[model samples]
Structure formats: structure tokens, C-alpha cells
Target: MALECINLEHVPASHTIHAALFQNIKNASFLHQQLLAGNTEFEYALIDASVIISRLHALAAIYRAVNDLLGNKLRSRNVHSEIVFSLSPNNNIAESFRRFGISPETTSLLVIKVSTPSSPAAGEDIQSHLSKVVDGEQVDFSDGVLRAMTDMVRVKKIYKLNYSSGVNGRGKENAVYGSDRTSQDSKELEMLILGSMALRGATN
Candidate 1:
């Protein structure tokens, strides 16, 4: 199936992470509405893929949120919402949802489902549900796929890595990997984003 079952290290064995990517989403508004209505079946972390940098970037956020879940330190409604909230450099839950979470206009979408002992979801079940609900092309969740969908400008701005860093605000110059310098710059930006995510509440 297109849904990948990820085995994250340092987490409980009962917690299994299932993720999927979708392109050319046609019913983002409907999905957004399900979230707004608090549909229990639609409890996945529905993120806007444009702001994502890579698979690692997304995994870092998931790791943080899952850790929080295990520690009983979740600040959001659940692990799914916490995953979205963990992407922000700041502790604004609502704003994080607006910037990182899915919207009506989101074309490329990232869906994360953490199956816990309490609410266990099989990989097949997740894949089937997503296939029916999300009207989009299911693609492999890979770094290469994510790179094509990333909006570096939005990512940098959200992480506050714009003017302070020497890299240009527009993603074009920094994203070009034809040159070694640009490739290194892109990697540096990913590191910066991870750092920002890691230090989210500590700074404030």
C-alpha cells in the first residue's frame, strides 16, 4: 500500500506511525471540515505538504509529538494535533495549525496517523480510509518527493531563518542543488528548521 508504517526508535513498541502523501488533492475543504467537526475517524495529522522540507523534517516533528504523548505532556488535544503543533518554532497551537496544518487550498497533503494501544489502527485500515476520504494521488512518502513539494520560502519564514541567515528569502536561489554551495545551504536550512522545532518552548 502507499501508506508507510514507520518504526521510530526510542518510542514504545505499541506506538506505530503510519504516514502517506497525496498530490493534487481535490477535497481538501471536505477534509478540513472533518477536522473542524472533530470526526473521531479523521484524527490523523493533516498537514500542508508545501511547508515541509523533507521526510526527516516531518519525522522530527512526529518524534517530538510522540515523545510528548508518552510523557503525558501533550499541550494539544491529542497526539495528531500535537504533531502539527510541534512543527512550529513558537508555542502558538492555533497559529501552528494555520501555518502547518491543512487548509482548503492545500493541494499537496501529508497525513500522519500514530496507532497507539488505546486506539490501534492497522496499516491496511489507514490506507483504505485515506484512499476513500482524500481525493488525491497517493504517492510514496520520501525525501525526494517531499523536496519537490517544499516551499522553502514559507518554511524559512515560519522558522524565522530568513534575513538573519545569509540565504535569500526566495527559495529559488537556496533550493538549487546544481552547485555544491546551494546543496549545502539547503541542508543547513533543514538543520535550522530542526533546531527551531526542538527549541520551540524553551526559547519562550
Candidate 2:
């Protein structure tokens, strides 16, 4: 009832992301790196205990990527970017966007045209608009990273794959960008934000 299923074919705008992004594994590759992060099986294979700590390595890699994105760009006065982490309903893109910063135009709703209608996490249309426009098989920054153009906010997502005993990823905001979003951290983060801005401007 929450508008789970959709048809992307109906949403023409998404087609613009075609080829440039959807054609490669790079866009979504970030997911593969972090999804299976906390399993101790890697360490148990002789020293599986190392698997737990290794999880951070992957996470750090992601942070590094984010750093890269941010370091070179994202320093303008108009750019408002925020990162969110999702843990429930399996931390899929749907849940990831649920916690994302909301803009007036795109409240709690997300439209997707997933082939599997039975998929429990196929995203929901917040307002339940009867004639909601559903877009199919399009480029979405939903699950792992969402980068939006200037208007208001630039949002990214973190899948909380680990917790106390595992990679729960609590307080990710502080962990990633720090509480103030302006605190001094490694030069890596500064460069990452700047890099994001440069990339965004290049696209324009």
C-alpha cells in the first residue's frame, strides 16, 4: 500500500542518466565493496578474526572515495550536501533514502521500476499519489550514493552493515564528516569535498 512497485518507463527525465553512468560497474561498484563487510569468514579461513577489522578497511576505502569526491569539489556557497546511513529493512536504497534529507518537492517518496514486483524493498511513494510517475531501470544514487544537482541539497547514503558485534555503522555522520561538517580532519576529507564540486561543475 505504500506505493512499492513502479514503472520507470513512465518517468522520462531519468533517461538522461543513460549511458554515461548506467553503462559501467563503477557507479554501483561501491555497493559490492561494503555490502558483505562484516563477515568473519574471511578471518576464520585460518585467521578469520581479522575479518572484523578488515571491515574497517573497506569502510575506510569508501570514506576515501567520498573524500576524493569531496576533496576536489563541493565548496560552493549553494551546495548543501548531507550523508545518511540506513540500517533497517536490510539497508537497501529504499531505506537509505528514507533517512536522507528531505526537500519540499520530494518528501518521503521515491519512484523505481524494479523488475521484481515482489521485492519487499522496492521503494515507496510517500504521498500515495494515484497517478504517480514510475520510472524503470534508471540510474539512482539511492542505495550507496545520491548526488543531486544544485537546487538545495546533495545527499549520499551509507548502508549500516555493521553494529556492535557487527558493522552497525552508528553515528556515521560524525564518523564520516564529523559533527560540525567543518571540523578539521585528514586533508583527505577536504580534498574529497572539493573534488565533488569540481566533478559537479564539470558535468554542467
Candidate 3:
């Protein structure tokens, strides 16, 4: 498998590689519903950078395409929207996640994409649970604008891939690589992708 890089910020607004990913999160109610559902993995509400919406959009297609390609190796879970790349006796989960990184491994990693707006407000309908968590930096892209935000994501259970850092934050914190701390292992990454794809305008 080829290594992949996610320009999360460029994702939703990207007409270049992933136009389908961010087609409708802006001012869309259905899209908002989709975002809400995507965030449910966290027992408490955790906000993703705005760019996650775009990543969600692009991965929707990738998930569908890859599932067909791997067939058995990859399974898409609808309830949680995660691409379960089964690491057989020959493979490991960490290696799979590494394949997506500059220097990756054969073990699979869960890529759970989320949707956060350009701005967030209270009472948006989210959870407030925090246990076994870590803080990190988040670099996000939106409509071509590059910026970073201080991120707090859940990290237990996912592996060494925990504690993702920010790339575009205006503050002092630098970016790190790991899982999103919005919730816990109760939800899978693929489920979030499915919900976020719904944030895009519906397909014919």
C-alpha cells in the first residue's frame, strides 16, 4: 500500500483532490446533522478543526472504493463508519496506520474524520466526558486558509498513534500525530466517515 498524507484543512474546500468531501458543510442543516452524528463517538463533545469536514468528504469516496478493492481485507462498518483493515497473522494494526504516514507501519490505524465549523459555540449538542486523554496541536485547512488550533483528543486504546498535534495553530503548540480525543473507543472511525459524508450534499 502507498503512504498517504491528509491535508485536512485543504480537504473540504479542496477542488483539486477532494472536492466531493466539503461540498455542503457550509450552512447546511442536513450537513450539520451529519456532523452531530459524527461527533457522537466521544461520550462528551469534542470539536474537530473545520477542515475535518473536507477530509470526511474525500474519505467517503475512498472508503467505498477501497472496500471494493480489498473486499475482505477491508470492511466498512455502517454503525460507526470505520474502515476495519483487518491485520491478519501476516500483518499488524500499527503497520497499517504507518502506511498512511511518511514512515508508516503494517498495522492498521483507524482514521476517524470529524466536522468542526470555522467557529464553535456552546450548547451545540455534545458530550463533556474526559478520561485517559491527551492534548495536542491541530493544523487545519478551510477554503484555502491554513490555520492551527489547540486540540484535545482521546488517546487510550488506539495505540502509539494517540495524541495528535496541531499543525496550524496560531499559538505556541506544535503539531503531533495520533488519534482524536473527542470521545472513546465506543465508536469506530468508519462510522464517523459515513456521517460526515452525509454532511456533503446528497448524491443522485
Best by lDDT: 1
**lDDT of every model, 2 decimals:** 0.88, 0.24, 0.27
Please give, for residues 1-204, the per-residue lDDT of candidate 1 as tens digits. Answer: 378999999988899999999988999999999999999999999999989978889999999999999999999999999999999999899999999999999999999999999999999999999989999999989877777787777777788776233245333334445477666766787898899989888987
lDDT of 3 by residue, 36-114 (tens): 4655443111122222223343354444433433343333332123222221111343432222211111111122232
| Tens digit of per-residue lDDT, candidate 2, span 1-204 | 233232233333321110101111221222222223532211100000111122222223223323433354322111111112211112233343343322223312222221112221212222222133221223332222221211111211222222122111321333444333323332333234334433432443
TM-score of each: 0.93, 0.17, 0.24
Top candidate by TM-score: 1
lDDT, candidate 1, residue 196? 90
Kindly indicate the candidate among 1 and 2 with the higher TM-score.
Answer: 1
RMSD of each: 2.3, 18.5, 16.8
Residue 94 local lDDT, model 2: 39
Model 2 residue 134 lDDT score = 20
Q: Model 3: residues >4 Å from true position, as ranges?
A: 1-29, 32-74, 77-147, 150-204
